[model samples]
Target: MSTDTNAIGLHTSTATQLAEHLNILLANYQTFYMNARGYHWNVKGNQFFELHVKFEETYTDLLTKVDEIAERILTLGHEPMHAYSDYARVATIKEDTHVSDGTTCVKGLLAGYKSLIELQREILSVASDADDEGTASLVGDYIREQEKTVWMLSAYLG
Candidate 1:
């Protein structure tokens, strides 16, 4: 094998591809996180307390993943995108500007979670193919957890 691989022994090209996917994930997570925060603060009506707390918990967890994802990109010898502009340019999860209704916020969150899980699944496939166990495991855990979240959120909507 060529010594031209990255520090973790993955080829530069493979690492680059992984990093690219990771960067996109990072952007989406950041946007999702911000949206959760907005929901937590703005949500009103009968389910307000419940949804506000849930959104807070969700956004806090997202903050942690945002850090982990950036670190992973660094591990692959790439810089994580740091600007809101970069996130806006790349993220598929749109910002929630004015949603305050409890049910509406829940629906928005469900949509974001679904999108994140889908993107993570794609990344998991790439990571599995490249033998990047770290990336695979990270996103695999995310997928599992978010799948459950999706189910619960759907039940909430129903």
Candidate 2:
């Protein structure tokens, strides 16, 4: 590791920035996952079966991403934020409620993905500048996956 960076080969300041952004991403994923769970539990209509399964899958993926992000922060030699209060303060995505309607749930998901993608792009730029390939690659993968999800959800809403 370089003198300017931590043991993990990331610049100390850059690691700090990455950890902060990752925490924000984690918060958003948590909120999105919870919303999906709510949607899965409460959604009612002719499209119930399809949407229910879809929401379950979506939340499961989000849960996995949440863990990955927190672990990434640890790899960067920083502590991951855990409290809901901290999440609320740092997260751009707001917690949604009572969205039982399938269309409304899908729209909410699209909006959340919009916020998440923008943040991830910002992180990607920072990671690139810092030569943090791990963070850059992680954010890149998320962007690709989420862009496809956005496209699908948009088509669903259409």
Question: TM-score winner among the candidates?
Answer: 1
Where does candidate 2 stray beyond 4 Å?
none
Q: Tell me which residue pairs clash in candidate 2.
A: none
Error of 2 at 144 (Å): 0.4
Residue 107 error, candidate 1, Å: 0.5
Candidate 2: residue 28 Cα off by (Å): 1.1
Pairs in clash, predicted candidate 1: none
lDDT of 1 by residue, 50-76 (tens): 888899999999999999999999999
> In order, how many clashes per candidate?
0, 0
| Cα TM-score of candidate 2 | 0.96
Model 1, which residues run further than 4 Å from truth? none
